[model samples]
Target: MGLLDGRTAIITGAASGNGAAIARLLAAEGASVALLDIDGGGAANQAAAISDDTGAPVFGARCDVTHAADVEAAVFQTLETFGRIDVLVNNAGILLDTPLPGLDMTAWERTLAVNLTGPLRFIDTVAPAMIAQGEGGAIINITSIGGSLGFASYAAYCASKAGLMGVTRAAALALAPHRIRVNAVAPGIIHTEMTRGLYADPAALAEITAKIPLGYVGEAVEVAKTVLYLACDLSSYVTGTELTVDAGYVAQ
Candidate 1:
């Protein structure tokens, strides 16, 4: 029996990287999953692959987290297919590295829209449904170390993630009575397409990896495992907390 057997999950930005890893893990653990991504085709293909690999009921849909209509449609579609939403992984986010000296407001706004407001849209659309389900649920937000440790050129990204931390805590308090748990997972220097650029430059990769106490880059599966823990009964008592999966980067 898998930890998430009979449960259902909705993972945003699940076409690739960490989001895809999380979806695959949860589905393998027996949860019906909806992989929602801006790249609809990619999401569908990944979902089909996971279904084949895990024999889990999984589907994919196009969802733009920044838009309310898109968020509503995706939630409706997931409920229509899976019957209930037991877990929500708000993994849809974008990072724009821009310094404050001459930062473009456009970049800042876009970053917040996708990274911060996007999660809000999902919570607003899904929380009420979870409450109505009466069985309680879990909401996990994907954050970054940039939220805590300021990055030189990541003002917008950092600010957005920090705001998400606030959202996770506030949402937890608001939904505690409903048995719904809200939490945030902060990943550090994970190997993903999002960080592929850094990998291309050996010097940059080494410099970045050197800062991590683990002495290496993290993988998507590791982050997925953390999300799985929070999604299942193993973390039943955990809520409104930020679990840092940064290879001890914050400790330094």
Candidate 2:
């Protein structure tokens, strides 16, 4: 049997890239999935594609996770369709690469809203249902290595992710009594559509990859597998941890 057999999960920002990878992997491992994103049509398309590939029930809904009403409505819809939510992956985020001295306040605020507040909104909306079920659950936040270390052009993103790490720890404590586990995954230099532009410049990509012990960038699937481990029973004893899937980049 698959690790997530007979389970149901909700994955935010699942229209493409790492979010899409997680959705596909979870569904493959026997979980019915709900793909939530602000991009309605794109999410629908991804849902359809995954359902076709895995022969598992997959649903899609338009949800701006930073908005309370949108997150609440999406949670309700997920419950109505799938009965219960076994896992929640907060994978939605935006990057505002600006130096602190000349950074735009507007961009900083927006980054925090999507990267940090979005996860809080989801946890608040879903945790109650998870508690009521009494079956326990998992919450996986997609943070970045930027949170752990400072990068030159990623001030706002780093700050938001660092805040998310704090949220992960706090949520883990709050939900432990309910048997709900909360954790975060910090990925570094992953090859996703979001970072394709950087890779387009061969020298830049090489320079970045050189810092990693693995000597290469990671794939979305690699990150997805780590997420799956956190979501499954294999990690029953694990909680309030940050799993760094950074190819040893941070070790240097």
Candidate 3:
């Protein structure tokens, strides 16, 4: 049997990149997945591909994580389709990289909305149902090393991820009694479309690699595996923690 057999999972921003990887992996492990993203077209395509590959039921829905209505609707749709929610992975985020001096308030707000408040909104929408199920659930937030380590030109992204960490801890504590586990994954220099622009600059890529003991970028599946572990029964006793999948970048 697969690790997530008979479970239902909701993955935000699952159209592509790390989120899509996680969705595909979870489905492979026997979970019914609902792919949520603002990009409905991409999400639908991803869902179709996963269904074809895994022969598992996968659904897709458009969601703007920052909006309560969107989040609520998405959660409701998942429940309507799957009957119950066993896991929630908040993986939707955008980098609004800007130094403090040149930072735009609008960009900052957008970053916080998607990176921080979006997860909060999803939790708010899903927590009660999870509690009602009385079987507990898992909430995995996709944070970043930037949340803990300061980086140049990433003020807003860093701040939002840090805030997400805070949310993870607080929610973990509050939901423990109900058996709902909340945790976070802080990825370092994962090769994704989000980071493609940065990798375009050789200097930036070199600078990022220099900090990692692995001396190379990580892959989406590596991060997805960590997320899968956290979401599965393998982590039944784990909660309120940040799992850093940065290839020893934070060690230095």
Candidate 4:
């Protein structure tokens, strides 16, 4: 038996990269996964592929986490199909590489809307059902090491993630009474399509690799495994914590 057997999970930004990886892992462990993304076609294709490969119930929907209507529709559709949501992975995020001086209000607002407020809306919508179900649930927020560390050009992205950490803590406490757990996963230097441009530069890649104590770049699956732990009973006693998957980058 798998850890997440019989669970239903909602993963945002699951069309590709870490979100896709997490969805696949969760489904493999017997969770029915709903992949939501702004790229509707990509999400649908991914769901079809996973369902075909694993013979598991996987669904996909077009969702812009920044929009309340989209989130509501997606959640409604997911509940209609899967019955209940047992796990919610808020993995949808954007990186705006604007320095403080060059930052525009629009970009900052958009980043927060997608990265911070988006997760809140989802929790607000789904938490009631999770509470009503009385089986409890897990919520994993995909944060970044940048949230804890100061980066020169990642002001907005870092701020949003840091704010998400705060949300995770507050939500954890608020939901604890109902047995719902909230946590954050902080990743560092994972090689995904979103970071393809940086890894394409050999010098930049080498510089990043050197900083990692593991002497190698991380993979999407590595982060997925961490999410799996938090999604399942393996982390039953863990909540309101930030698990860093950064190869000890934050240690130094």
Residue 244, candidate 1: C-alpha displacement in angstroms: 0.4
Summarize candidate 4's per-residue lDDT along 119-206 as a digit string, tens digits: 9999999999899999999999999998999999889999999999999999999999999999999999898987898777999998
For model 3, the superposed segments whose C-alpha errors exceed 4 Å read: none
* Cα lDDT of model 1 by residue, 1-252, tens digit: 999999999999999999999999999999999999999999999999998999999999999998899999999999899899999999998988788699889999999999999998899899989999999999999999989999999899999999999999999999999999999999998999999999899999989988889899999999999999999999999999999999999999
Runs of candidate 4 with Cα error greater than 4 angstroms are: none
Worst 10 residues of 4 by lDDT: 96-105
lDDT of 3 by residue, 120-186 (tens): 9899889999999999999999999999999889899999999999999999999999999999999
Per-model TM-score on C-alpha atoms: 0.99, 0.98, 0.97, 0.98
lDDT of each: 0.96, 0.94, 0.95, 0.94
Best lDDT among the predictions, by candidate number:
1
What local lDDT score does residue 61 receive in model 3, on the 0 to 100 scale? Answer: 84
User: Candidate 2: what lDDT?
Assistant: 0.94
Instruction: Give me the runs in candidate 2 sitting further than 4 Å from their true place.
Output: none
**lDDT of the structure predicted as candidate 4:** 0.94
Better of 1 and 2 by TM-score: 1
Q: Which ten residues in a row have the lowest lDDT in candidate 2?
A: 95-104
Per-model clash counts, in order, read 0, 0, 0, 0
